[model samples]
Structures are given as structure tokens and as C-alpha cells.
Target: MTRLYNDPQAFADEMIDGFVAANSRWVRRVSGGVVRATRTEPGTVAVVVGGGSGHYPAFGGLVGRGLAHGAAMGNLFASPSAQQVHTVAATAHRGAGVLFSYGNYAGDVLHFDQAQERLRAEGIECRTVRVTDDISSAPADRADQRRGIAGDLTVFKVAGAAADAGYDLDGVVRVAERANERTRSFGVAFSGCTLPGADAPLFTVPEGRMGVGMGIHGEPGIHEADVPSADGLAELLVSSLLGEVPQSVDTVRGARVGVILNGLGSVKYEELFVVYRRVAQLLAEAELEVVDPEVGELVTSFDMAGVSLTLFWLDDELERLWGAPCDTPAYRKGALEPAELIDDTELAAETAAEIPPATAASRQVADVAVAALATMSRTIDEHVDELGRMDAIAGDGDHGIGMQRGVHAAVDAARAAHAAQAGAGTVLALAGDAWADRAGGTSGALWGAILRAVATEVGDERVPDAAALARGMRAATDAVLRFGAVVGDKTMVDALVPFADELETAVGDGAGITAAWARAADAAAAAAAASADLMPRMGRARPHAEKSLGTPDPGAHSFALLMRAVLTTTTNGRNAS
Candidate 1:
């Protein structure tokens, strides 16, 4: 368990600050994360990598002369926001373009793709290569769905080396993609990790047993078994990977591969060497030549008692790139020449936001929106522990925190907009931006989309009626569907769709805004409770859906709670009138 923390919510920020302080020679502070302190060659393709915090050397630690130009750090176990990614990319881009690379998780994919779109819109060439290298997460037929693990190092290393070697945007992307294709990893855990200030671990393994194919983000393993001896464990890891080599490789025999025996937090270095001893013998026995086998922690969960092995199949080109000289705060290979540092004056200046003009009537409605967000903030705070407990059943236990961060930021932004005399639509839109920017995960993105959709319908020109609100709810449902979910997928959509339908029906039946919202809230609550029986078909929780049986989805439950809270706020307004 994590023993030290000033405040649980502030852990990630504190860690980044300390890291930058200690590694001043390698990295400098940026808005979202750290960029390389050292300057790069002009026109070189900048490699920007990122993900949730707690995966140390993986993201921020890798920012230096020969690795990632910058890293967008997010809250623990959550993907960085799109705004974070774009800020890092903008700061890192030299003259040519930028290449964004990270693990293939849902939040990471959503945020990185959004950042890529933003960069391109501004005429800055940006591309992305998602690393999918965990063989245990999916079948070889659908390898693209695999989650990245220790193999991330191989892909990032090669991509960074390629970028350092002056590859253009296309060339860097190709190398990164090829590296991801060649790399494969599998992990096991003796115990689960604990988040800071959390009273219990995310999951637990029975004594004398181990979890197989677990994820780095405290996700429970797919299977469990009695703990094996060092040799036995090494054989298990090796055989599983050898059974399904990359499509490009005909056979493991006579192939040269880069090996990584990664320790996931609690595993000591001596234990890894003991396991690697057997792993090395097994590789030789299989007639594969091992090149530059790394045996240490490269990526890690907070304190997970686990380890993973990665194999990067090496061709001539790959071999050269793999052996390229590099230097970073965490990992180093060969040697690197000294580089110039970024000038103090070259840092980006903060820009002020330009609020659109709003009419007086619109400003009045904006006050109501601000009040609604305040209600949401209070409601989320009240149910945070309950929501987090539900999410901990199968998913990462951060939904409650994410929602709190998002709604609080939304409330703050809404207040500012209302004070600025902005329209209701502009207030909600600004609040949505803050929610997404501060929340930095799947829930955050979805809520942001929902708010933006509602804002479009509740324009500044008119007073939002029950019909307009229903239409906005319908649009919110559509946006959620377009973001890739259906009613039975066991997501928030299950509750959202019902609420939207019931709201439209209630409004059609001549209900007032408060009445319609109260009815919709009831529908959403029923739908959310019903979701307890559903097996998840989407998101990180899908693989372990069975474990979540009889527990409501955290997202669905939170949506229901938010609906009811907002209903109360509206009803109160009506009573006051």
C-alpha cells in the first residue's frame, strides 16, 4: 500500500514537480508535462509520448535528447487530456512535424486522436502510432486490440531514435508502427497495486498463487494459478510468446530479438535476474539469438507485485535502430553528444481567452447554468466514494475522482463565464472545455461531448424550453453513440439513452422543464440499476466483465445521480419563481 501522500488528488502533480526538480539536466517544466531541456536539431520530427501518471520511466522520464521530445502527463491510471497532448506537442514541435505515440488504451486513443486533429487544423503536421504489444489481452487475429505494456519501451526507443536520426514524419511513423508490430509482451502479478490514500489494494491474489496476463493499470489478471518456480515461470512466459510470433516472422528459430524482463514496482532487481537467468537459457534452447536483453523496470504500476517480458523481433533495419545511441533520465544506451538547452525566452506565453458577445437575456440564463453546475459539483462530491467503490469492482477505481475533477472544473468555468456576462450556450461550452481539460479520461471526454451538444441546442438567442432541453438530451445521446457505444454495451449510454427518450416523451406529453427532468431522472435511475445485470462489451472493463456482475456500472450510476441532482436544481428554481 502507498504510505506517503500529502493529498490523494494532488499526488500526480507533486510527483511531476519533484521529478522535474531532480532531473533538471534532462527535462524542463511545460504546461502539461516536461519537454526535453536540451534543444534538438532543426526540422527533426519531434516524438511526443504520454499516458497516465505512475508509469514513471515510460513517459516523463524518457524525455531527453534521444527519446521523446515531450510527454503529456495525466492523473494516475488515466490518459492525459487532449488539451494536455496538444500543449506538449506545440511546445515540442521544431520545424518539421510531430509524432504522437502511446499505449492503445481507450482514453489514450481518444485524447491522442483529438490532439492530432487539432494540430493538423492549425497546419502543424502531426501523426500517431498506437503501441499494441500485449499478447495476453487479445487473440493474434485481433492483435490490434491488445494493450501495450513493457513493449512500449521498444517502440518508443526505435521511434525516438528514428526521429533523432532526422527521419521525416512519414519515416518516423513507419518505424514506430513496425516496432509496435514486432513487439510483444506478457505479464503476471503476485499482488495488485494500491493507489495513494486508498485503504485497500485494487485486487488481491491468494497466497501461493499468481495472476496471469494482468494489465499495468491495476487491472486484474485474466486468470490465476499457483505460483510457479523461477524456471517454470520463465518457461510459461517464453512459451506463451513463442507460440504466437509476429506475422512478419516465420519462426522464432534463428531470429534475433530484443528482450526486456521488466519488474512491475514491488519486484526487486535480484528477483528479476533470477527469473531472467531461466529466461535467457530458455531463449537459447529455442534457438533464438537474444540481443541486448534489458532486465529492470522500464514501465511500472504504483506498487504492483508483478513482472512482464517483452520480445521485439529484430530485422537488419530494426537491429540498427534498436542499438542506436541514446540518453534519458531513466534508460540509457551507448553514448550521446552534448546538446544545447532551450532558451528561457523561448517558452510559450500564456494566452487570454476571448469570450463571445452575449445578450442580457442570455446572461440571465447563464446564471442558471452556473447554478446547475454548482449542484453537480456538490452531488458528485457526495457520491464520490460510492461511485469509486462500484468502479473498483472491475474497472480502475478512478471514475469518482475523474467525475469530481471534471464537475468541479466545470463549475469553476461556468462561474467565470457567468460573471463575464456570457450567454448560456457559451457558459456551458466553456465549462465543458474545462471538464475535459481537467478530467483527462474517457468519462471526461464523454461528459465534455454531452455538454457541448447541449450547448449547441441551448443557444444564446432563445430561452431554453423543455423541448429544447429534450432535443439537447437527444443530441447528447447521439454524440455518445457516435463516440462508439450502444445501449446494451453496459456503459453510461445505457442510462443516457433511456433518460433522453423519457425526456422527449415527457416533454411531448406537455410536462414542464422540472417535471420532464424529474421523470427522466427516474428513467435513468431505473436503467442504471438494470445495468447491474449486464456484461460490459466496451472499454477496459470488458475483459473482466464477469467480475462486475451484480454491480452497477460506475458511469451509468453517476449519470443517474447527475440527472437527479440537476432535476432537483431545476425544481427548486421553479419553486422560487
Candidate 2:
């Protein structure tokens, strides 16, 4: 069963019970799990929000201090009943009035509309503000119908601040609407989520793919695409948001802005920062001044592997309210220095030094290696499913995917260069470029560094024998460990260290190049298999400690597999001769 709950009805009750238990001083359930927070001052404009239960700190948990005055909790992935909405509104209503704000979803509209009518009959002045910031969800002419995601926080923050500042109901509603207008959000989900008591996820996404425009409650996305690097994904998300809003501060006429990088449940802070680095770069390029930036799980779907980006365009009034003190369990504004540009001169010098001068003989060897790696790319791809499933037992299941993607990209680069010029060294240089360009994450960078180090060693050489190959392997190994810091960490080093050691021993024993390669490959494969019993000592799996036991390190396994493929191909060629 995908969900952990015992039954469907018990889901709502359990959630409300926990919420009130934890926040008894500020919030309580009136009826049907409709949560209300006592206003600090009576007759102040009441800001009410409600939505499905899974989006916590959204409509409910946001109901304190400088946020919502009342939160009408709904069932899992379902809108609250009209009765529940009305009950919460009545409890929060003072002599002044009430303002209802929520995402632009069909169920929300239906229930909130019913509650508005009922509250008006009881002499409570009520108004509604809809959050419609997802540009991917609707056409330009119908942007008002877009779904709200992380942008809800900006709406509630500005609206609640208005109410706290003693704005009347109409004024509060106006400021809330203005905040909604200035905000835009978009999200990409790598996987779906399961609701309480459900046997299946609310939606499904194919592995190694990302669904752009996926909804908060595991709704299907607008389209699915191959998962790109964090930088590429950040560009896609930020560009889409900028397309909807103004691209520059000049276009916004020097308006202050707030950027929120929100993780949907399961994405960790490390991955979020990878995405945020690109986001800050993009915003600076656009010349927009970020008044406040937030990064974390402000809103989430249960265990969804995804992230959402929200941008709030700010004027003087919104900026003042944004800076207003807020002390909540989830939202906070801390002191931050202005963003600064990073110096790239050192990086430029390093890149120039890394690129080797092209030569004919070196090109041929590089081409052959790239082709060999490409031929084994499918093997890596096939292993990804098994590796991921195994990793889920102990580590995150990304090893197979990462290696396959990095190798395929390297192979494609080599083939393209070989096609352009049949010469040998051109292919190797091209493969190195491809590996550097397409590979991502720590493994990708390490793999790219290894290839580049090999290229530098073989620069302009027509033929590399056992000694030259041994030298290149040693250099590559040193570069990988230097950059990755995975030596003796039970990672790829398990396979790589043995392979390098065997190659050096074979060379000292005067073994032929082919014999040395065969022995090294076998030793590497054996070392990789033996690592299954060793504990993971590095990367994300380190925290789990013993959990990674019995699961072979993905990096080690890939290295072993690649060694086997290269050796098998070389030995077969010798036998045929």
C-alpha cells in the first residue's frame, strides 16, 4: 500500500488531532476539522485559508502570528465541505469582516463560494482572493485559471500582515489580491505521491523523467521530459517564471522581489541548493533585486520528489509587510546580505589548462574508447532499474541513471566528432567535451575529470603502449580521488584502486598490454563485488550507515562493468586475430 493510514476517514481525523495537539496555544478545531486561531485583537480583519490536508503550513499550519487567522482543513486531496468552511469562518469572524484566500482549484471554488454566502447571511462581511500563479497550467488569456503552488505563502504573508496592521476587510482583500498578482510559481516532479489510506500514488511518473507543471496533490503534469542537470532544470523553471512576470528590475521599475525555492517533501536541502545556485544567477542576470529569498520545505506533498519556484514582485507596501516580523513554525525572514557576483578568472584559467591540443593518433584512441563506452551505455541503462531498487534499500537510487547518462553523453560526443573528422585525437577531445558538458552531480564531475586527465596525458601521442596506458590510468585515478575524495571510502575506489594496482603489477612483471588489461579487469570486477559487504563511508548513504550494507556501491559497480566491457572487447579482438 502506498499510503500509511489505516483507513480513509481516519486520515483527516489523525491529521487534525496532531495539528491541534502540537499547536493548542494558537489553534483549535471548531467542527469537521476546521481550525481557527484566536485573533490577537477582536474586530480585526480575519484572513481565512483552506485547502486539502496534505499541503501543510499552507491553509492550516500557517494560521498563527503574521499569517492566516483561520484555516479550514479539508480531506486528503479533497476540498473541505461547505459546512467546515463556514464553521471556521464564523469562529474567526469579528465585527469587521472576513477575507477568504486559496488556490484556484475547482473544489476550493465550490466550497469557498458556498461558505461565503452562508457567512454573509450571518452579517459577516466576506471576500475571496484566488491564487493563480502557475504559468504552465493555463494559456496566457486564461492565466487566472492556473493552479497555485508555493506562491500561496506570499499571498498569506502579505494578507496576514495587512490584517495585523489594522486594515479593514476591503483593504486586506485588496493587498492580498495584489500579492497574488505579483506572484508566479512553477514546479517539476520526479515522482508521484500517495494520499492517506491509498494503495497507489495519486499520479505516476516514469523513472529518470520529470513532469513539468505537476500539481501539489500529485496531479499529472503538463509534459514529461528527460531529467536534466540541476542547472538546466533551474534555467527551465526560472525562464518560465520570468516569461510570466517582468524579466528585469527596470521592467518592474525597480520593484523589490522575493524568490522562494521550495522542496516538495522528499527532496533534501543538498539538492535544493544545487538548484538555488542557478536560480540566484538567473535572477542577477535579469537585474531583479531579491528583497527576501527563502529555501526549504515551506509547502509540500507527502514524499513527492520535486521542487517549486515562486517569485513575488514587490512594491513598497508589500516590501514593508514582507519585512514585518514573523515567527511561525515554517516561515521566517532572517538577516541577509545582498547577493554578490563570483570571480570566474581562476575558473577560466583552469579550463584553458585542461583542454589538450588536438593530434591525429590521440584522436583515434579517444574515438575507440568513446565507442566502447557508448556500446556499453545500454548495459549501464539496463542496470539502472536494478541498481535504483537496490539503492532504495540503502541509498538513493540514482547511481545507474547517473552513469548511463554520463557515458551516453560521452559516447555521443565522440561519435559526432569522429563523423565530422575520421582522425583519432578529434574524437577523444570531443568525448571529453561531452562528458564535461552533460554529466552532473559528484559522479559526473569525477568521470569528466578522469577523461580529461587521460586526454592531457595522451596529448599528441600516436600510439600508447602498456607503460603509457599505466601512466594515464594512474593520473586519472589520482584526479578522480583528488576531486571526489572517495579513496578507501568503499565507493568506485573499490574497483578503481584494484584495477590500477593490477595494471602496475602486470607492467612490472613485463606482461603484454592485453594480458595486463584482462587481469586488471578481473581484479576490478572482483573488488566491486566484494564491496557489497562493506559499509558505505561517503556521500548520501553515509548517514544510513549500516543500511547500505549488502548493497553494492553504484559507482563501484559501474566502474567494474565498464572495465569488463573494455576487456572483453579487447580480448575478443586478439582471439579473432
Candidate 3:
């Protein structure tokens, strides 16, 4: 369990600041994550690797020479927002293009893909290679759907090494993809991890039992079984990974592979050495040559009692790249000569954006928006635990915390904007940015989109009527749909689409905005409940779709709850009366 935290909502940000402070020689705090403190040669491919926090040494810790040029760290167990990724990539990019790498998770895909598109549009040339090395997440035929676990180190290391070796963007991408294809990982947990201030861990294992095929985000394993001895566990992980040799590797015999025996969190180094002893013996008996084996907490879930083994099947080129000299905060390989430190001015200071002027009518509307946000924040606070419980059934249990952080940030931004006499549209837009920036997950991105659409419809100059609001709702629906989730995908879009449709229908028939919204909220609530019957077809829950059955989709449920909460604001101005 997490024991130390000043504010659970502020944990990630604080951790980043502290990490940079301690490792200023290797990394400096950037807007989103960290960048290499040392200067890089111009036209060198900038390798930007990252994912959710709690996996140290993996992200920010890996930022330095012969490693990641930058890392886009997200909130705990959540992928970074598109804006976050863009900022890190832009900050890291020199004359050469940027190479973005991370775990193959839904939120990471959505945000990184968006950021990639944005950079390409700006002619910054960005490419991405998602690590899919977890054997438990998908079958061999669908390996592309697997999650990235501790094997992320191998991919990141090789990519960074290749980039430092002066590979162009295309070459760097090819080598990184090859590294990912050649890597395989399997993990197990004796217990789950707890977030700061959370009453309990995300999931738990039975006493004397171990969860097999566990994820790094405190996601429970695919199955549970009695705990095995060190030798037995080693046999299980080794045999499981050995069964799926990359097609490029003709056979396991005589194949040179780099091994990582990673502790998830609470597992001590001595205990890992005990397991690795058996692991090393097993690999040797199988006639596989181990190269530069690493054993420790390379990637972790906060205090999770878990371990994962990764085998990177290396060819000649990969071996060369893997042996390259590099230095970073957490993980240091062969030492290399240090370069000049980056000037402070080279880094941009994060400043609040100035709000555009608005009329008194628009400012009045902004005040109403602020009140609605306050109500939404309260609703999230009340239901946060329930939402997290539902999400924990099949997904990483961070929904409640993520929502809490996002809404709190949104509330703060909206209040500031309202005080500055910003228009309703500008207020909502700033709030949306804050939400996505702070929360940083699929839900955060979608909510930002929803708010941005509505803000556009209700511009700073005009007081939008019901028809305009309905149009904004329709636009929000389309914005979500563009993310590729359909009506039955068991995402927030499921409830959002129905709510928008119902509101549009009610407004078309001459109903007031309040009445229309009430009807829509009713539709959303019903849709959210009906979602209990669905097996998640998207997002993290998809891998354990069966487990999610009979539980309402967390995103949909939260969306419904917010919808009804907003109605309270409409019923009574400021929802305080």
C-alpha cells in the first residue's frame, strides 16, 4: 500500500518534481515529463518514450544519453494526454524527427496517435512504436493486442541506442519494431498495489495464492492459483515465454537473449535474486545464452508484490545496440562521456493562457458554467469509489481517482476563468484543457473533446439557445464517435450518444433547455444501467471482457452521473439554492 503522499491528486506532479530535483544531471522537468539535461547532437532521432507513472526507471528515469531524449509521463496508471505528448515531443525534437514509444494500451494509443498526427501536420515528422510484449494479454495470433509490461525496457533501450547510433527516423522505427517483435514477457503477483490515500489495493489475491499473468497497473491476473516455489514459478514463466519464440528466431537452442527479472514493487532484491537463480539455471539448461541479464525493480506498480520476466531475443544488430553505452538517473549502463547541460532558457515555462475579453452576458453565462462544474465535481467526489470499484473488475482501478483529479483541475480552471470575466465557451475550453491535462486517460481525452465541442457551439460572443446547445451536443457525440467507439462499445459514448439524441429530440419538440436536459439525463442513466449486460468491446476491459459482464461500464456510469448532476445546476441556478 502507498504510505506517503501530500495530496493523492497531486502525487504524480510532485513525484516528477522530486525526481528531477534528485536527478538533475540526467533529467530536467519539462512541461509534460522530463527531457535529457545534456545536449544532443543536431539531426539525431529524438527517442521519446513514456507511459503512466508508477513505472519508474521506465519513463523519466530513462531520460538521458543513449536512452530516451524525452518522456511523456502521465498520471498513475493512465497514459499521457495528446497535449502532453505533443509538448514533450516538440521540446525534444531537434532537426531530426521524433520517435514516440510506449506500452500498447488503449489510452496510450489514442493520445499518442493524436499527438503523432498533430506533429506530422506541423511537419515535425513523428513516428510511434507501441510495445506489445505481454504474453498474457492476447493469444499468439493477436500478439499486437497484448500490453507492454517490463519488456518496455528492452524496446526503449534498443530504440534509444539506435537513435544515438544516428539512425534516421525510418531506421530507428524499423529497429524498434524489430526489438518489440522479438521481446516476450510474463508476470505474476502475490498481491495488488494501492494508490496513495486509497483505502485498499486495486485488486487482491487470496491468501497463499498468486495471481498469474498480472498487469503492471495493479490489474488482477488472468487467473489465480496456489503460490509456487521459486523453482516452480521460474519454470512457469520460462516455459510460457519459451513456447512463443519469435518467428525470426529459428529455435531457442543457441539463441542469445537478454533477460530481465523485474520486481513489480514490494519484492525485495534478495528475493528476486532467489528467483533469478532458478531462472538463470533454467535458461542455461535450455541451451539459451543469456546476455546482460537485469534483475531488480526496473518497472513497478506502487508497492505491488509482483515479478515479471522478459526475454529479448537479440540478433547481431540488436546485440550491438543493446550493448551501447548510456547513462540515466535510475538505470545506468556502460558509461559515456558527458555532454554540456541544456540551458534553462531552452526549456519553456508553463504559464496560464490569457482569457479573451467577453461581454457581461457572456460573463454571466460563464458564472453558470462554473456552478455546473462545481456540481459535477461534488458528484464525482460522492461516486468516485463506486466508479473505481466497477472499473477494477476488468480495468486498472484508477477511474475514480482519475475523474477526481480531472474534475478538481477543471473546477479550478473554470473558477479562474469565470473570475477573469471569460465567456462561457472560453471557460469550458480552459476547463477541458485542465481536465485532460491532469487526468490523462481515455475518459479525460473524451471529456475534453465533449467540452471543446460545446464550447465551440456556444462561442464567446453569443448566448447559445436550446437549439444551439442541442447542436453542440450533437457535435460532442460526433467528436466521441470519431474516436472509433460505436454505440454498443460500452464506453462513455454509449450513454453520451443516447443522451444527446434524447436531448435533441426533446428540444426539437419545443421543450425548454432544462426539460430537454432532464430527459437526456434520464436516457443516459438508463443507458448506463443497461450497459451492465454488455461485455466491453474496447479499452482495457476488453482483455477481460467476460469479467466485466454484469458491471456497468465505469465511463458510461460516470458520464450519466455527471449528466444528472448538471441538471441540478439547471434546476436551481448555481445548484446551491
Computed on alpha carbons, the lDDT of every model, listed in order, comes to: 0.88, 0.71, 0.90
Q: Give the Å error, residue 272, model 1.
A: 1.1
**CA shift of 451, model 3, Å:** 0.6
How should the candidates be ordered by lDDT, best one leading?
3, 1, 2
- How well is each residue in 347-452 modelled by candidate 3, as lDDT tens digits? 8667779999887777878888898999999999999999999999999889999999889989999999888889999999999988988888888888888998
Clashing pairs in 3: none
Residue-level lDDT tens digits of model 2 in 340-381: 222222111212213345456655665566556665676776
Number of the predicted model whose lDDT against the real structure is largest: 3
N/CA/C clash count, model 1: 0
Q: What RMSD, rounded to one decimal, does every model reach? A: 1.9, 23.9, 1.5
Q: For candidate 1, write residues 51-170 as lDDT tens digits.
A: 999888889999887678999998888888888899899999998999999998888888888889999999999888889998878788888888889998998899999999988999
Off by over 4 Å in 2: 1-3, 34-39, 246-254, 333-577
Q: Candidates' TM-scores?
A: 0.96, 0.57, 0.98
Candidate 1, poorest ten consecutive residues by summed lDDT? 568-577
- Considering only N, C-alpha and C atoms within 3 Å, which residue pairs clash in candidate 1? none
Positional deviation of residue 4's Cα in model 3 after best superposition, in angstroms: 1.7
TM-score of 1: 0.96
